[model samples]
Target: MKFDELDGKMRSFETHHDRAVMPEMYVVARIDGRGFTRLTKEKHDFEKPFDERFHDYMLTTVQHLMNCGFNIVYGYTQSDEISLLFHLNENAFSRKERKWNSILAGEASAKFSLLLGDLASFDCRLCEFPNSGLVTDYFRWRNEDAHRNALSAHCYWLLRKQGNSATEATQRINRFNTADKNELLFSNGINYNDLPAWQKRGSGIYWKDEEINGFNPVTQQTVNTIRKKLYINKNLPFSEEYSKLINNIIEISGR
Candidate 1:
């Protein structure tokens, strides 16, 4: 076979099962740390339940993803997962699902591993939303999930600190409702409501227009200019307000 013919035949096999996201649909890529339980707890000395150092690592990874050659408008990270919201008109890689999944996973894993000084990996999957409302709801879901996970972690770690085994802590947390978990923390003198908002609501990264004053050498005057800068929000709101915040971000991105 000719060289071109042989190459064409192999390329067809590689792309035969390829999929692309539909146009006009909002794309959100969720990248989650693989085996992070053992990675965070056993292999590392990060504080139980929550740690500022670990949180900073996740935030830094998210920031890198936002700037890593994609038209991502917003990023959110909590626990060992990061969610990226792409611009509505993004057509990168011709909207290939596999391309987004593989590159995002590779980028996140590489960035995080470099930060941690260890071999860490992440897996990525994409979420498609047909409308802005659904996009808003999607973030709201993750925000609420952060709350639930935070509560559970605090309760579980409290039990462990009180001399309960891993199994005992898991069993007790499994049986407790939200109110029960809050009370458990309260009885132990740790108020769930008083915890850092970032732990309960996760952190958000988005671009905002900042006014920068630059000296115009030729004109001999300081001129104001607008620049897009990434802003990280550790203190996020909840419920309906969070939905509004998501909506506003989409609007600002020209969706």
Candidate 2:
């Protein structure tokens, strides 16, 4: 009935179910926007199919998370979701998945809301990979998904512009195979192959080291320095080459 007694009881109840991730495994945190369909419609009139503004917000949030005390090596975003690949040894939040997920989603939601001046929310889940090959496969899977979604989206919007309702567009796209969708876009003068790579393969964020010369005012000399910074690359590929690229990142992070 005292303050200390009540606090201890409730805190234990909260942490009783906390589970820790294995320390040596690759960890991935995937955060997805909740109810984004209606939220995007009501708050921001995001462009049909894809919008740079919405993606900019997602990218900013990803950058923020990468800097938030975690050894996150790579960040990937597609549509309304973002996935963060954490270094193998990262034990932030004591590797507690629930706390990490909750705090990450909360922080992402807050950052996005501040960036957009509207309330946005994200929900997160953790994925553990035993090896780097699985990591490469995971990214490839998502990139392929982006390719499929991008194709479908462009076709759907094209039909909508041509006066088909939402239901009709879905039904029409449902009938078309991948080749047929590409042909549809080609017939309408839009080259699916020529679309922005980010739209087709999602975007990536990683670190790049640049060497620069810094002036020393006191000594009147120039000092060569290596600066490491986060780089957002939107032109990533979705081919086997891309799998190699992701594997390289995983290898570097492992080191």
TM-score of each: 0.98, 0.95
Q: Model 2, range 40-113, lDDT digits (tens) per residue?
A: 86667889888888888889999999988788999999998999999889888889888889889998999989
Regions of model 1 farther than 4 Å from truth = none
Using TM-score as the measure, the top candidate is 1
Clashing pairs in model 1, backbone N/Cα/C closer than 3 A: none
At residue 208, candidate 1 shows an lDDT of 89
Report the C-alpha displacement of residue 165, candidate 1, in angstroms: 0.5
Cα RMSD (angstroms) for every candidate in the order listed: 0.9, 1.5
Candidate 2 has its poorest 10 consecutive residues by lDDT at 39-48
Candidate 2 TM-score versus the reference: 0.95
Question: What clash pairs does model 2 have?
Answer: none
Among the numbered candidates, top lDDT falls to 1
